[model samples]
Target: MSADEGARHPEDITVPDAVSAPDAEGRPRRVTRRFPLFTRDTARPEGSGRAAPLDAPAPARQWPILAVLSLVGIGLLLTALDVFRYGTLLIGVALLGGAVLRWLLPGVGMLAVRSRFTDIATYGVLGLAIALLAMMAQPDPWLEIPFLKDTLHFTVSG
Candidate 1:
């Protein structure tokens, strides 16, 4: 609203004293300020920083994610080339590696997708599940569970 309009309507939300007060940053502090629907400023997730110095090349600065992505790409190629089990295992290992990087490194660039704990948990759980499933897949499974076999038989038989 215009200053004249606010002056006319004293009952409006124009807290003259509070709005004029300077904050630590010297910006006007609004006492009755509500959160904006969309924030203009956002804090980066923890560990989301360049792996290399600012002067380094883009690839070097973002090497952590690049490494993970490269592994995943190779895994996809292997899967396409008919090495199903190994390819899936490789992909899972890549995710697990990403989790390890996030945990150990102080900065991981784009590898830091979310909060450290959440990212680690997500990557670890998904990686382990994929690897375990790959190990148990198809004819002559590597890690067999008799109970699972029975349950599968029962469900299909029914």
Candidate 2:
């Protein structure tokens, strides 16, 4: 046999496991496992290419993610400075902006997390939820639900 014939490919050669299954009838069998796409490959999300030209700086290349992160950082800072309602609203707005950028822009850098639809759904839903919660926060809520208090009281006190 030629040297190429003596050298078997990894996938072509399979050794059996120590233990045998009832279905194997005591014969040795090759054990192989399949991996999902994420494990096998790390393809970028759709429209996740650089937002700016290659000649631009790194920050420019990834400005979309930077913008969202900066807004979130500012929101946290505002929250620490005792501006809870507006701070939370700003954070929600940041997420909404990410969703919008992902939707409208052809290349959003790292802002595109998953597929276009999935990223939009995730960001939009989280942003809406946070914004609604901020509007309904305690002490003097802007959008109070009349039945929510009753429901909470019933669940807690009943």
For all candidates, the clash counts are 0, 0
Global lDDT of each candidate: 0.87, 0.87
The lowest-lDDT stretch of 10 consecutive residues in candidate 1 is 9-18
- Provide the lDDT at 30 for model 2: 46
lDDT of 2 by residue, 1-158 (tens): 89998976656644454243545476545434634223335888999999999999999999999999999899889999999999998999999999999999999998988999999999999998988899999888999888998999999999
Choose the strongest candidate by TM-score: 1
Q: What TM-score do all the candidates reach, one by one?
A: 0.77, 0.73
What TM-score does prediction 2 earn?
A: 0.73
**Cα misplacement distance, residue 147 of candidate 1 (Å):** 2.4
lDDT of 1: 0.87
